[model samples]
Target: MSRNHAVLTALAFLASVLLPAAASAKDSSYGFDTDRDRFGWAIMSGGNSTTSDVEDQEALDKLKEEYGGDDFLFLREGDDRYVIRDRALIERAQRAVKPVNEAGRELGEAVSEQVHLALGTSKDARERARLGRSIGRLSREIARAARRGDDTEDLERDRDKLQRQLDDMEESSRDQRVTVREKTKTKTRSEEASRHLKQATHHLQDTMHDILHDAKARHLAEPMR
Candidate 1:
């Protein structure tokens, strides 16, 4: 063959040798880009980090069999950050929101029960005083939870205000008890004590209602479901 023809033939042989490898690399690089395949990739990557290469590849193959098809893309955007073309982040955010929302709901219910207990029965001054003290303790718990940012700031403020109201109710109950004791023989003293008891009960109910409302609002704003 002429020198030019020989050179051209050698170039053709080199091209044939290198082209398949280049094509294979390109195919491997863009392999998968679907949700199921991406999930499999994540599982495989996790398993491989701890297991032998044989075990890792076996796990990956099993996942591929269970899921079928390589149609997913596992894109690592940053450290501990991954992008799934699925609703993974939304599902994660929902999971995180659940417990906090449930806590708010439970707190609201407890506050409501305390309110009902305080208001449902008419009691003597001393009994009312005890109920008011209980209500005050519940309010403090609610305030602490709110301050910890488990709920809203408005919730914390409402709890603090309710605590103050409960404190006032307790003091009023004690005063009514003292006044009744001082005038035990008087006929009007019984009526006066009843009036004070009713007032304390009403105050307790109102404070509890405020606390429940605040909690419900916070819960509704960020529902677990």
Candidate 2:
């Protein structure tokens, strides 16, 4: 096959194996600020040697031997040090984001299930109250998931239905107490908003692991030196 076709085929295979909902959605930017510094120069802080000191190929070879291979990218930092980033630290940092995504996803699923149960119950004032609470919670969860780049279409659809139902219930009910103690905010961040983080994080970790391993292996096999 042609190179472009082959590339497309490879991407198609990945899509087939990955979560369809997440793969089809637009890129998310929920934790960008938190992860912005996670992937730059890998280096041992304080103890790192300056790149200026490696004046020859022999010095560079020793540096390569110190790290894994010479194939990895090397760059000078503002401190004038030739940095070899702490891959282990970077890996851990990347892994740290996993829990956040998971929290978002699991929380979203839990809220969605709660909403489902509320909808199944009798449409009494109390039920309206329950659903009214669920609608707000679900909206936050859906928004969180959307922010994390997960497909919230299904959840959003359900939330919208709940809103419409709640509106109808409110209009017909003479009791204003149904919404008297409505508490939209929560102490927990995940509870407030974040449901899609799990799905996105899982896929991201998997993809990053595969790519990193593959590239490292490929380069190690053909060392730059």
Candidate 3:
């Protein structure tokens, strides 16, 4: 009933097969094709064997919450004694969104620094769209400072800082756009991969279902937007 119960069952055999010479050797991570630990997959080669499951409701609830998806699915070959979960898809989804999230963090830091500089000085007009302007706007700001008989040094310093951050923010936006596109693309690929897995099961005369009676393995990572 535990998450690793089925995996441990298969893994014990794997350990024996992979390390027949070494008894009591610690388990090391292994990779074949795309699947890793918890990223459920069965390979055609002897490297990986198929897994099976009946739905475990508590596990399914937890998976839905973690992934924010009701559409989480798996393939069960009819009576094959192994069910394949979508952990790989969840992992890919999270990775797809990572670039955008990192870019957002950088943009926030830059904007925060620029905001502080703007607030500490005389640019009350900074509330408007003045902060993310062109270098020409910086010139106007310097000229205006001279007319106000104010020292232009502070304004120039802040202008430089704001300009650099503005550039960073723009770049971040572009990166986010690209990452979102990638998320969509990856989602499609994941669906295709799942279909292929289903086909593999079908060839073995196993049945595929959107809902399994008791899915023991649940995909628990959230999808990235």
Candidate 4:
């Protein structure tokens, strides 16, 4: 096959094997992000170290070792460093993640079931009010847990202050009464259920963040799109 055809085909296979949603998406930032992640670089972050001449090659080598590639695909740029172009692996090992993926799905489903059960059986307005606040706090925490990128000293301080404020709000909210209008809500969830849902969401995002991070994609690739 031609080089371009091979590249496309290889990428397609990898995307399908690694991230099912990516291979099927017509237009999705998630899919594109998945591609960028698989390459161990973000197309959004611009940096000289992220160039194919150095950064990408380092990522490629790690993948080669991880996937048991028989032949290397790179050109030497300097002493022991390479410019990676074609990431086509000659003899690639199949990634063994079916059992792990199935387990994750099963755990998610179990959590959903448990949360539904809790929501179904409980009807404490005070508890529901508390659950609402907990959910809101968890939503914010989920966002924080999923946040990426380097933080400046000022940003770190700001985040710490914001976290303190959130903690204060959560603590003070415990004493606040839910009005009649709030108690008459058609839908309400128990604290257990709310906590389960929010925790599960947070866990999922954390897992994704860890995956991209552990891929050694600490920087972006140059000529980012």
Candidate 5:
């Protein structure tokens, strides 16, 4: 019934509530999967394939005739004329959304840090509350960067709710209890950030897939080899 003992008890209760959310953020379900890792695509060429400008130009003309413009690249190695998706475009898309992925990881880390603070009896309550606000800020930043000119209403709403929760945490005088309550909502915040990250990754993946699908439809690219 001592003051320190009472505080320790409340902290333990809060840690238990927030720990699962923290663990979920740290898992592989996080939004850090890069485009290359998600795609696992390889150029269709053989061992005897040797690069030739003459054959490449000829192949390019053929591809242009079929697929219109530079959407697909024609690679001529030896007798193997393989058509592949434009990797430069995919790389460019990945670069554009790189900030989203980084922010996702940072958001997860921040959630984990807040949970860690809650579990420690010596940790500061106000520090944990500040981290809660940080998580909200991260969510909004990810949502903005991930949208890529599209209207992300659902994502925007999630980020807005998170920001509001952070505002509540900031204004609360009971830092210890409020911080714990806010950390409990880390699940929602982590999920919002993750959803944005996945959207960004899918955007790049879809771009690559669209070109691949096009080539397949035109019989320029073969899935088997």
Candidate 6:
């Protein structure tokens, strides 16, 4: 063969050998389907179904095997239609929980610190009463934060400690209030306010602990967790 014809022949032979291997690599990378349009359809359907009337169960199975079902928020039933219970609400809630939990933790820590400081510096009956009320308010905030459902065991433990501290403060405040009122000959009540406060705090703490434990258990049960 002439020089130019020999180069062309070699080029053709290289293409023949490389083309099939390249195609096979692409197939392995993206799976059996090589069409970009079909991949787009698969992704759009949330890997549930590929095309109209084409079950695409293979793709769905691959997705479930890889990413798990919970990671995907939508389920594909038909080609063009999907089932979403509350897309906007679910997305909003998912986005909101993280920030709310983080803010709650920071606020709880600050409140706990202030309560500790107040307990140490309180000298007189009035000072003790003021600190007690402040601690009580902080305890309520911690309880509310816990109800938001982002607490870990550590967070729950800290919250429980804060609640107990608040209960102690309230009891001290009630006794001081009674002493002050009796000394001045004013009408003093015999109601057990501290007991009620303690009960409320304990109830909220227990509820929060249960919620956190349940969440942890559910997380452990998830396939990809």
On lDDT, the leading prediction is: 5
Name the weakest run of 10 consecutive residues (lDDT summed) in model 5: 44-53
Residue 31, candidate 5: alpha-carbon lDDT: 22
Clashes of each: 6, 10, 14, 0, 1, 0
Q: Which one wins by TM-score: 1 or 4?
A: 1
Candidate 3, residues 64-165: lDDT per residue as tens digits?
465453334423233233323455542332343233223323333333323222221223323222443233244334433332234557766765676555
**CA deviation > 4 Å runs, candidate 5:** 1-87, 96-100, 122-188, 214-224
Could you list the CA RMSD of all candidates, in the order they appear?
32.0, 15.6, 23.6, 16.7, 14.0, 26.9
Ranking by TM-score: 5, 2, 1, 4, 6, 3
Instruction: Give model 5's clash tally.
Output: 1
The alpha-carbon deviation from the true structure for residue 181 of candidate 1, after best TM-score superposition, in angstroms, is 24
List the lowest-lDDT window of 10 residues for candidate 1.
46-55
Better of 3 and 4 by lDDT: 3
Q: In candidate 3, what residue range of length 10 has the lowest lDDT sum?
A: 27-36
Each model's TM-score, in the order given? 0.25, 0.33, 0.23, 0.24, 0.33, 0.24
The residue-by-residue lDDT of candidate 5 on 1-225, one tens digit each, is 333554454445334322322133312112222332223322212211111112233444455566554343433223444566545543443454455456446555544444343332223444434444444444444533343333456655765565565445445534434355565475665665557565655664455466555656776564323
lDDT of 1: 0.32
**Ranking 1 against 6 by lDDT, winner:** 6
Task: Give the alpha carbon lDDT tens digit for every residue of 145-184 in model 1.
Answer: 3322233345446544654554455445533332333222
As a whole number from 0 to 100, the lDDT of residue 38 in candidate 6 is 26
Q: lDDT per prediction?
A: 0.32, 0.41, 0.33, 0.30, 0.43, 0.34
- Tens-digit lDDT track of model 2 for 95-201: 54456545554554444433332332234645664664566455555644453345768887887687667656655666433342331322133334443454455
- Candidate 6 runs further than 4 Å off: 1-69, 72-93, 121-130, 133-225
Ranking by lDDT: 5, 2, 6, 3, 1, 4
